[model samples]
Each structure stands twice: as C-alpha cells, then as structure tokens.
Target: MTPSQRTLLWVYAAIIAMWPIRHLAIWFIFRKLDILTPDSPRLTMDHPPLVTAIIPAKDEEGTLAECLASVCAQAYPNLEIIVVDDRSTDRTGQIAREFATADPRIEVLTIEHLPPGWTGKTHAAQQAADRARGDWFWFLDADTRHSPENLEIVMEYARDRGAALTSLLPEMRCETFWENVVQPLAGIVLMQSYPLFRVNNDRSSLAFANGQYILIKRSAYEAAGGHHAVRDRFVEDIRLAARVKALGLPIRVAIAREIGSTRMYASLDQLVRGWSRILYDALGRNPWRLLGRLLDPLIFSQTGHVAFVVALFLLARGHTSPFAFWLLGLSVVHHIFTYTVLARVYHMSVPRSRYVAWFPVANLVMDVILIRAIKMCLTGRVTWRGTAYGPTVTSSTRPVTKPVSPN
Candidate 1:
C-alpha cells in the first residue's frame, strides 16, 4: 500500500474507534461517581427530621406489601408512610389497607377518579404530599425494596451537602434472563445520557432524578411547586429536579446500592413500554436524538463492540490481511474492559462469557425499546397504568387538596 493510502486507512480506523472510546469514558465516569453507602456520613442529627415516605400505586398488587414493609423497616425514627391507591382495579388498595391497619405509621389514600391533565402517579403523589406532616417527602415507588439504613444515610448525606432534593441510584434487581442482560445495559445508557455529574452540579441546568427513590425537603418541595408544578409531566421526577435546580436549590444523586433496590418491570412487555415511555419523555420527544438513542445499542454500547469482535473474528479467520487480525484483537480487548466496568457499575457480577453469548439478543431488545419510544413520541401520546396521555398534560393552578378518608 502507498504511504498516503495507508495513512488514509489509519484515519478511517481512528474515526470508527471513537465510538467505542466514548462508551469507555462514560463507564469510567460512573465507576468514579459518588456512592452513598451504609457507613457514610458520621455526623448525626440531634433531633432527627420527620420524613414522610410517599408511595403511589396503580394496580401494583404484587409488590405493594414488600414496598410498604421495607419503608416501615427504616431505621430512622420520626417517620410516616403514605400509600395512595389511585384507581387500582386490583387488590392494591386491599393490601395497602392491611398495612395501614397493622402499622400506625402507615396511611392509605384512595382516589376514585383521576382529574384530567395529571398523570396518575403524579396525582397520587400529590395527594400523599398534601396529607404528609413530615419535614421531608421521601417518594418511594411501590416496586422498590429498601434496606433499613436507606433513609438514615441519605438524610445525613443531604444534610451535609445542604441539598434540597436527593435522588438515590438504587441497586437494580434483575430476575429473569432478559432482566439480567437488558437492564444493566439500559442503566449504562441512561447514566451516560443523563450524566449524573452534570445533574448534580449546582450551576448546571441539567437535572435528573429517579422516581423510584427521591427525597426532597418539604420547604424545597414547596418552593419548587411540588408535584402540582409537574403534574402533567410523564417524567415527573426529572421535571421536579429541573425545577428545584433551576430555582438554585442544591440537588444530589448518589450511589445507594446498599440502601435500596428496584425491579422496574415484571416482563419483557412491561420492560419495553416502561423504558419506551422514559426514553420518549426524557429526551424531550426529539426525533433526531431518539433515532440516535435507538441505534446506540447496536453502535456505541458494549453490544456494539461484541458484534464487531464477532464480525472481525470471522473475517480474520480467512483473511490474509494482518490489519484484520490486529483490529480484531483491539476490539476484543475493548469489549472485555467495557463488560467488566459495566458489571462493576451495576454492583453485579456475572460470567463474561455468558454475558457476551447473549449480548446480541439483548442489544436487539434495547433497540426495540428505543424504536417504540420514538414512535410514541412522534405520535404525541403514550399510555401509562392503562391511561393514555398526550405528549403533555396541563392543569389549572390549584392548591393541594385536603386529604379524604381512606375507603
């Protein structure tokens, strides 16, 4: 090969290699990210703040009991638990009522109908907040299971940082084969997409929070207009965080793997819809970004590298070119490094060979999630908890309603 031709080929290879390098950088960022562990923050509050744990449920019969039990197990004293049964057709309300009967700290609220222009969860959360008498509103999803120290450690972290809103990065609990593979890769995509560093930066406008576990001081929650301000938002947690941060309130996102764990979906069907809604709303319904995100699984993630290695392996087996063999070796090394880092990020340990063997199938599932999300975004509506909502919902300005007696 001529000198100029060789130089041109090298340039092309470098350009193609940038994608994998970018993925590595994202994983490294997560590896060094802050973790709020069990033994963190030695300082103790003289008088512990009253924290109200609010959970909004809509047909969450399967997980409601465990969720309530976890919150009730919190080591922190001066705690209140509110569970809103928002038009659940299942045994969700019955289970919640059972908990409320057994524990004086637990309160259950039932809503007969969802007021127009508010997402069901947001509306339910607002109801719980309205009746909460705690100094802080600790929003926990019904699907999440928390460790005893979950509340205490986060409380200290927020107090030390003087943060108004705190979003905990929970340990994602995966059970099924699809859950094991797709969830971790999805977490990697979300972390990179949101960039927790930017979200937590005081000056950065970027803000994000996981709905599964968000702790907000009552004053800050009120200042940011609470859920009422973001009632129409499908991705209310993120919207609430943005509002808080925009108001110059300090927000913190931490690694809380020891504190809490959440299993987001029960099946592949739920997984697709759940992630699709998040991606569509989180990306601000931008088609171009959605398209790129759809392709990320196949191009920029470890799955992309895994596929590349397989392709190059096949080529190198028969090709006489030394470049093919060298490229194959490099790609294999990159995949191994990324795979290990991703496992560490999730606090999960799995055999690399097993993961790689199923990587391609999982990658396709991820793509389907983004694709469905894009279509939903373009269509300007999506369904949640069996309710269909437009791209946006708007409500008349109103004060928090007084709590009604549980049915």
Candidate 2:
C-alpha cells in the first residue's frame, strides 16, 4: 500500500480502539449512578407540600383515562390534578370530565383555539399553571402512567436536594419489535449528548429532563417564565431545564424506571414523527451543530460497522492485507462489546442484546430520521398533533384565552 493509504489504515485502527474504551467508561459511570424509587426512606408523607399536576391532552382519548387514574392514585396527600383538553377531536374532554365528576380535586379545561406563536402543548400547560393553586407545579404528558408513590417520592427528593426543579427519566415500555430496537438507540444518543452525571451536578450548565414527568416549584416556574418562556420551542422540557439552570437554581434528574413508565409511541410511524419533532430543535438551530450532532454518532459509536463494510469492499476488489483483516476483527468485537454495554445500561434482556448484529441497521434508521428532521426544520414544515409550525412564527403576540365548553 502507498504511504498515504498506510497512514489512513492506522487512523482507522485507532478509531476502532477508542469505541470500546469509551463505552466501557460509560458503563462504569452508569453503574455508579443512582436510580430513584418510591420506596426510598428519604421520601415521606410528613407535612407534604401541596402539588398541582398539569396534563396536556390533544387527541389522547385512548390513554387519557389510565393516565388520569394514575395521577389520581398518587400517595401524596395534598394534590390536585388539572387536565387541559386542547382541541381534541376524540373523547379526551369526556374522559377528563368523568374523572373530574368522580374526584373533587380533578378539574378539566377545554382550549378551542391555539394562540398564534405558541405550540399547543406549551399553551395548554401555561393555562393550567395559571389556574393552579399549589406550592409545586407538576407537568405530565397524557400518555404517562405514574406509580402510586411517584409524586410523594419525587417531591421529597426535590425538597431534600433543595432543588427548584426535578424531572425523571421514565422507564420506556416497548412492546413492539421496532420499539425494542429503536428505543434503546434513542436513549443512547440522548445520554451521550447529555450525560446524566453532569446534568445532575449543580455546577454543570448541562440540563435535561423527560417531559413525561417534571416537577418544579411554582415560584421558580413563574420566575423562569414558565412554559411561556419556551412557548415556541419543540423540546420544551430540556429548554425549561436549561432555563432553571441558567438562573443558578438547583435541578435534579434521576431514573424513574420503577416509579413510572411511558410508551412514547404506539407504532413506527408515530415514533418517527415524534422523534423528528424533537431531534431537529434539541441539537440546536445552528446548521453546523446539527450536522456535527448527526455525524458524531456514526463516527464514534458506529465506526466498527463502517470499518466492517470497508473491509468487505476491499476484499471483494481483490485487495487484502493484514491491516485490513485486523481492522475487521477489531471492529466486529468493538461493535459486540458496545451493544452489550448498551443493553445492560438500558436493562434489556439477554436475548435482546444478542441482536447486536442489527446495530448497524438501527443506526442507519436513526440517521435517516435525523436527516429528514433537519430538512423539515429548514423548510419550516414540521408538524405535531395535526398542527404545522413555522420557525419565524413563535412569539406570543396575542393574548391567550380559554374556550367555553358545555360539558
């Protein structure tokens, strides 16, 4: 081989070596991390502060009843639930009303019109917070199911940590084959971008949260401008967390695998659209950062697969060498080890991790979604909950009002 080609081969080998080392370090970090549960002694019922739970619903009739039921069953004593029915064509409003009628603490608000510049979910959350009368405001999605002690546990954790904001990364419940494969990949990407350890550290500016379960002090919420502060952003959860961190307030994030679970999407199509709406904005509005974020995964995590492909191509062309063979072996081993670590971190079963051979395919699917999302964001054609939003039309220039519904 030429000198240039030999140098390139050495670089490839170096890249392959780094993959396992990086993942091994990550696995060690994850093992040392703590996951929160409802049974912890730190969580107690003593003088529990009043909390208001806000849920935003739009065409969520199928999951509304169960979600509301879970919220109503919280072990915390002083709690109120508000369900915002944001122009649902389904029976979301009816299901909410049934809950309200049976429980005095539950109230239903119907929103008919989405104000200009505000995303539907943020708008609904803002309205519910305005009507809330509690020391803490809990924002939850309609699709999440909480354990009976979830609220009590999270509230106590926040108070003990002296945190102004707290959010939990719910255990992802995946039933379908695609869900199992793709969900783990998504989690890897998210964790890599925002390391949990750094996010939990008060000194670090990095902040992240799952919108499925977020609890913030009412004062902090208002001081940070609430959902209205991130009214135009697609990933409001992370943005709000950043806002809290920017103000030098303490924010805690932990794994809630046992405390609560959420099935983000029921099918593949829904999953694609849901993540597309998030990845584009979460990476940033800058084109260079978006491209870097998209390429980083392929280079860092999927290097083994890429090397394997290149080795096969060289062999097919009747060009073979010891370096190429060594690269292939190292790449395959690295890929297997990386996937094994990921399965353990995500709590996947043994048989599931054995499907590590499909890692390349999964990475390809994710890359496609990222590219499509970037294109949509650039074109201002991103759609969520049957509403199309543009980049330029995000400021709330008009006043928001609640719709009167005869229920």
Candidate 3:
C-alpha cells in the first residue's frame, strides 16, 4: 500500500478504536436510568396532576381514532382530550368531533389556516392549549398509542422530579420490513448519541425530547411561552425543551417502553422524507458536523466486520498467528455485545435484535438514505403535512413578539 493509503487505513483503525468508548459511555449512562426494566416507576400515582392531552393532526384519519381512544382510556381520572384537526381532507376532523360530542371531557377544534412563520401543527397545538382547562398539557402525535397507565405514571413522574417539562421516548412499533430493519436502528443511534440518563439530569444545553408523548405543567408551559414560543420549529419538541432548559426550569425524561408506543414511518420513502424534515434542524444547519455525526456508527460497524473477514482469510491462508485469530474473535464478540445491549435497551425483539448482526450490510444501505436526507436538507426541499418547508425555517425560530396568556 502507498503512504496515503496506509494513512487512510490508520484513520479507519482509529475510528474503530473509538467505537467501544462511545458504546461504553452510552451503556453506562442508560444503565443508570434502568432502561431494561419494563415497568420502572419514575413517580408515585397518588398525586397525579390534572392533564390535558392535545393532538394536532393533519390528514391522520387512519390513526386518529385509535389515538383518541387510547387517550380516553388513561388511568388518570383528571384528564381531558382535545384534538385539533389542521385542515384535514380526510375524516380526521369528523372522527374527533364525533368523539368530542360523545364524551364531555373530549373537545374537537377545527383549525382554519396555517399562518406564515408558524409550524402548521404547532399553531393547532397552541390553539388547543388555549381551550385546555387542565393544569398540565400532554402533546402527542396521531400515530402514537398509549398504555392506560401512561398519564398516571407521567404525571407522577413530573410531580416527584419537579420537572416543568417531561417527555417519554416510547418503543417504536416496527411491523413492515423497512420499519423493522431500519426504524429500530434509528432508535439505537439516538440512544447511543444521547444517553437518556444523562439527558434527564445533566444541566447541559444539549436537550432533546420526543414529540410523540410529552407531559408539561401548564404553568411551566406558559412560563416558557408554550408552543407559541416555538411555533415555527420543525423540531418544536426539542426546541421547547431547550427553551425550558435555557430558562433554568427543571426538566425530566423517562424511558416509556411500556407506557406508550408509535409507528412513525411505514415505508422506506416515508422514513426518508420524515427523517429529512428535521435532520437538518437536528444538525443545526451544519453539514460537516452532520456528516461526522452520521459517519461514526457506519464506519464502526463496517470496520469490525471487515477486520473479522480479513483475519479469517489470513488464518485460512496460514498467514495468521494466534494474536490475529484472537483479534478477530474479540472484534466479533464486541460487536455482538454492543448490538445486543442496544437492542435490548431499546425494546426490540430477540430475532429483530439479531438484525444487528448484519450491521455491515445495513450501514451500507442506510448511507444512501442519509445522503439523500442531507441533500434534501441542503437543497431546502422538505415537505410535511402536504406543505413544503424551506431550508432552516428561520422565520419560525423567531420568538413571538406578543406574549400569550393561558385561558
């Protein structure tokens, strides 16, 4: 090999060396949160707060009914369900209105138009909050389903921790081939990057929240200006969490594998489009940083597999010594260990978890998707909820000039 090639190989080797350190950091951090426990309680049930569950949906007819049904079945008694349908062309608005008419606690609101510099969904959520009568607000997506005890558990968790804002990272339901193979891997990558335990406690600027299931106190929501404050953010959940953190409000997040679940994207096209919508926002408009952040897991998995194959080839050719064989075994063992732990912590099944065994192959396939996402973000071509959004969403990120008061 030439000198340049040798240097590249060394660079690859260094990347491999760092993988275990990153994995260990994630494992140790999540281990504190007790993520493996299916029913770990973060709070007591006796003092659960009155909560309003709000869903801002657009054309979610297929999932809206089941989602509302789940909210109505909450174990917590002091609850209200408010569904804001944002100009849905489907029966989403009709279904929500029917449910509202049937139940005194449920109310349906039909939003007219999305104003400029406002995220379509957040505009609806802000309107829902205006009509909410509860002391706490829970924002959930239409695709999300909850277990009966979610509200009771989450409310108690907020009270015990004195958290103004709390969100649950639910176990994603993966049924389709793309959903099963690729979707769970996204969860794995997220867990690895931001350890849940550290994120909950450490008072760092690095804040993240899953929009699927968020529970926030009304006072805190108003204090931080609620969804109005982040009206235009594509990733409003995380932006609101960041604002809460910036204002020094207490924040808490819990693993909610048993409390709730969601099927975010059904097909490969959906996955790519959905992920692209916020990938740029998630990257904070930095292409190089985004590339670096995405490259780690891909390179790490590929290197381990390549190392094992080469070592095996050498051994079969009688060119490998005991140390070479040991190296190959150690690499494979470490990959298995990390992947297994990641899958288990993220609530994937045993067989599906074994898909990590094909990390090398999977990484190769995902790189194409990541590249496409980056291109979409860079080109300012993102579409969500039947509307196209431009790059960066600068206008939405601007704080509202007028303060909003609770109703």
Candidate 4:
C-alpha cells in the first residue's frame, strides 16, 4: 500500500478504537449516576399542601379520559385537576366535561382561540395556572396515566428534597414497530446530550425536564415567570426548568417508571410530526450545536456500520488491510455492547433489544427526521396540534387568559 493509503488506514483504525473507549466511559458514568425510583419508602408530611394538576389537551380525545381518571384517583387528599381543552374538534372537551361533572375537583377550561406568539399547550397551561388555588402546580400531559400513589410519592420527594421544581421522566410505552426501535435510539441520544445527573447537580446553568409530568412550587413558578414565561417555546418544559434553576432554586428530576407511563404517539407519522416540532427548537436554533448533535450518534454509536461501509468500498477496490478488518470487528462488538447496555438501562426486554443489529436503520430514520425538523423550523412551517408557528416566534410573549373559579 502507498504510504498515504497506509496513513488513511491507521487514521480509520484509530477512529474506530475510540468508540469502544467512549462507550465504556459512558457505561461507567451511567452506573454511578443516581436513577431515582418511586419504590422508596414514602415520606409523611405534617401539612399536605393543595396541588393544582393541569392537563393540556389538543386533539387528545383518545387518551384524555384515562389521564383524568388516573389523576382523579390520586391518593393525595388535597388535589384539584384542571383539564384545558385547547380548541379540540374532537371529543376531548366532552370527555373532560363529563369528568368535571362527575368529580367536583375536576374543572374543564375550554380554549376558544390560540393567540399569536403562544403555543397551544403553554396557553392552556397558563389559563389553568391563572385560576389555580394550589400551593403547588403540576403540569401533566393528556397522554400520561398516573398511579394512584403518584402524586403522594412525588410530592413527598419534593418536600424531602426541598426541591422548587421536580420533574419525573415517565416510563415510555411503545407498542408499534417504529416506537419500539426508534424510542430507545432517540432516548439514548437525548440523555447523552442532556445528561440527567449533570442537569440535576450541575450549577452551570444547564437544565432539563420532561413535560409528561412536572411539579413546581407556586412561589417558584411565579418567581420564574410561569408558563407565560415560556408561552411560545415548543419545548416549554425544559425551558421552564432552566428558568426556575436560573433563580437558584433546587430542581430535581427522577425516573418515575413505577408511578406513570406515557404513550407519546400512536403512529410513525404522528411521531415524526411531534418530535420534529421539538428537536430543532430544543437546540436553541444554533447551527453548530445542531450539526454536532446530528453527527454525535453516527460517530459514537454507529461506528461499526460506518466501518463496514468503508471496508466494503476498500474491498471492492482490492485495498483491504488487517487494520481495517480489526476495526470492523471491534466496531461491531462495541456497537452491540453499547446498545445492549442502552436497552437494559431504558427497561427494554431482551427480545426487543435483539433488534440492536437494526440500529443503523433506526439511526438513519432519526437523522432524516431531525434534518427535516430543522428545515421545517427554518421555513417557519412548524405545526403542533393544528397550530402553526413562525420561525421568529419566541417564548417571551405573555398569554392572555381570564380567571376562573377553582371551586
């Protein structure tokens, strides 16, 4: 082989060797990070504070009833549930109203219009918060189902930790073929980008929270400027958590698999649209960060696939080398090991994790969706729950809402 060709082969071998080391480091860090669970012994409180649970609905008729039922059955004594029907053309409003009629604690707020510069979900949350009488505010999605003890345990944890804002990552429920494969891949990427341990313990201004279930003290919510503070943000949950953390308040995030689960999307098309509205905007519209995120998984997780492709090309040209073969084998082993670890961490079954070999397909799908999301955002064509937003829209706009009686 020519000296230049030999140099290229060494470079490729070095790159492949780095991936396994990175994966090992990630595994070590992940094992050390605290994985909060709800199975711990419950704590008792002298005074059980009233918590206003807000549910924002927009074309969520399929899941709203179960969500309401779960929230209504919470073991907590002092709790009120508010369901915001965000101009749904479906039975979401009707279901919420029925729950309201049956349970006096459940109130339905029907949103007639989504004002400019406000995302529908944030607008609905703001409306509920305005009329909330609780000392703490709980923002939950219409798709999430909570255990009866969910509220009690989460509240107890918040009180014990003195946390101003507490967000629980719900157990993800995936039923479809796409959901099973893509969800785990997406989650690994997300966690790597926003490490939960760092987000929880780091005082360097980084913060994150899942909107499926987030609870914040009323004082901290107000001090952080509330939902109206992030009215236009597509990923309002993370932004709100950042705002609260910026005020020097303690914010905690935990895994709540035992307490709740969320079915984020029913089908592939819906999943694409839903995540497209989030991923790009979550990058803060920074091109460099977006590029880095797009390439991260390809380099670290898919090094085996990359190596194989390169090896195939070299083989066809009759330029194969032992270094290339060794790199290919190493990359494959590293990829499988990393994926298995990811599956175990994310609570996927062994059968489901056997599909790790197909990760290249999943990774490609994710890349396409992310690139499309970026395009949609840049073109001012981002739409969520029937509301379209412009590229220039920001979270600084205040939402207008009339107060309603919590009683």
- Looking at model 1, the pairs that clash are none
Candidate 1 stretches greater than 4 Å from native: 1-12, 19-28, 301-334, 337-341, 344-357, 391-407
Q: Write the per-residue lDDT of candidate 2 for residues 260-362, one digit (tens) a residue.
A: 8888887878877887777777776545565776787777677766788888887788778776676677677767776666667556312234445566666
lDDT of 4 by residue, 349-407 (tens): 22234456557777887887778776865676676776667855544544444333344
Q: Which model is ahead, 1 or 2, in terms of lDDT? A: 2
Best by TM-score: 2
Q: What does the lDDT come to for candidate 3?
A: 0.71
TM-scores for candidates 1 onward, in order: 0.87, 0.90, 0.83, 0.89
Which residue window of length 10 is worst by lDDT in model 4?
345-354
Better of 2 and 3 by lDDT: 2
Clashing pairs in 4: none
> Which 10 successive residues of model 1 have the least lDDT summed?
345-354
Cα lDDT for residue 31, model 4? 69
> How well does model 1 score by local distance difference test?
0.78
Best by lDDT: 2
TM-score, candidate 4, is 0.89
Q: Would you list the clashing residue pairs of candidate 2?
A: none
The number of clashing residue pairs in model 2 is 0
lDDT of each: 0.78, 0.79, 0.71, 0.77
Q: What is the lDDT of residue 66 in candidate 2?
A: 89
